[model samples]
Target: MSAEQGTHTHHDDRATVARHAVAADAAALDQAQRTASPIAGRAAGAPSGLDAAYATQHALIARRTDRGERVVGVKLGFTSRAKAEQMGVADVILGTLTDAMGVDDHGRYDPRTAIHPRVEPEVAYLLGPGVEDELAEPDPSASIAAVAPALEVIDSRYRDFRFSLDDVVADNASAAAFAIGPWRRPADTGPMDNRAVSLEFDGRLVQAGSTAAILGDPGRAIAAARRLAGRHGFALRAGMILLAGAATAAVPLPATGVVGAEIAGLGRVSLRVGDGARTEAR
Candidate 1:
């Protein structure tokens, strides 16, 4: 039934159909995260447009906040042409980040709350005020206070990490957990777009790339974040962070293993996950 219907279905109107579709999709997503299990994607006639999908995602996050989860910041997706091509889309997307989705650096993370979790190294931005100005100039550093080596834990709510582009968008861009190393002043991590990053799993190099791959410059991703999120009444607040998308393809995170990353000059960041037998760390 449409959100307006408040109930009833079977021969539901188009608007009602969309409402029921979005509600079911959001419920499935929330349940997936709670049980750390994957679910099937939305059916072909469900909320399949980006605008409609994002509206559902925003509502999902709002429900979490109502339950006491504090918003921490935001993150960008499809920051590279390759990623856009892979997804059959041409625009980058933004997702909400929350304090509850953070794992301490150098500390243990619970692998129990994720289904086929994966990790990717990325450049993270610590925001300052006036980001709107920088976004206007298409220059992200002017509004960034610092940079850090970050690791993002992404868990697709869909089975086997399989989903259509719209499905992923509705799933909050696959965001899960995140950790960042010591923050460094812009002087140290100058020209973020050119930094080199590498990810090592259990001490073996697994993925590596340059930030340039992120929309030609990681900064542009931030600009995109500001513009896109602004439409939803979000502002670039100081102290907020922005995970500038993956530098390379994500690597499967094992139940028990060390995940570490290095950025050219931002220093190192890492997290450990114990045997998957545990269930409360999240």
Candidate 2:
């Protein structure tokens, strides 16, 4: 093929990929939503890398937004080097959080509506006005208004909870639901490193670890988000929450019970789970 023909073919291929990604992402999300079933993983047609994967994620989030799901914040995933290496991903990734995905501070979760629910503990960052402006780089400390204990609910659409990096990214990092505790200024959680994080399901310790498990310090995840979001032509914005990646491995959500997390300096946050439906605490 001639140079001009090759250029045209390349552009056409890009457009085709974009269209296919949109359709595939929408199908995956829609199926996951309707029946609470774990759909098949994207294999041969999955995006090639982080950029392409995020493009597909944006498409999926856009569909949610179109359906009136307001973007509430962002969540970081795989921030721990161990997790990244285990998952075979080169770096940490992000996912969009919608207001609809929020479980209030002490909300109740219904496992039946959630496909393969699992939870993780984390230190949440409340961004300030500084992030709204166009800065070359955001200072995690400067942008942080407060910190809190957070619990992230994750449910992968991929069958059997297995997926390639691109598949997980395209699934918006498996964001399902999240809750945050009372916020405290950074001073309250002084030097947030190695702080203990433990989760209990129905009064039994299900997962345990320290903040150090999350990329040494959860603050680094915020910094990474700040830098990364800017490259995508956006800002984190004030009033938006950022759930620094999970500090410990996720544990399956009990069929029906109260699940709680105790973060050494951040105090406790809990969610009650039912078999059929969910209720938010006012």
TM-scores for all candidates: the values are 0.87, 0.90
Which regions of candidate 1 are displaced past 4 Å? 1-17, 43-45, 132-138, 232-235, 275-282
The residue-by-residue lDDT of candidate 2 on 148-243, one tens digit each, is: 999999998878899888788788889999989889999877988889999987667888999998878888877778767865433478999999
- Model 1 C-alpha lDDT per residue in residues 113-224, reported as the tens digit of each score: 8898899998888987757564366466677888888999999999989987778878889999999989888876667778888898777789989888888888787678
RMSD of each: 5.2, 2.9
Residue 247 of model 1: what lDDT? Answer: 89
Whole-model lDDT values for every prediction: 0.82, 0.82
Worst 10 residues of 1 by lDDT: 273-282
Q: Count the backbone clashes (under 3 Å) in each candidate.
A: 1, 0
lDDT, candidate 2, equals 0.82
CA deviation > 4 Å runs, candidate 2? 1-6, 43-46, 275-282
| lDDT of the structure predicted as candidate 1 | 0.82
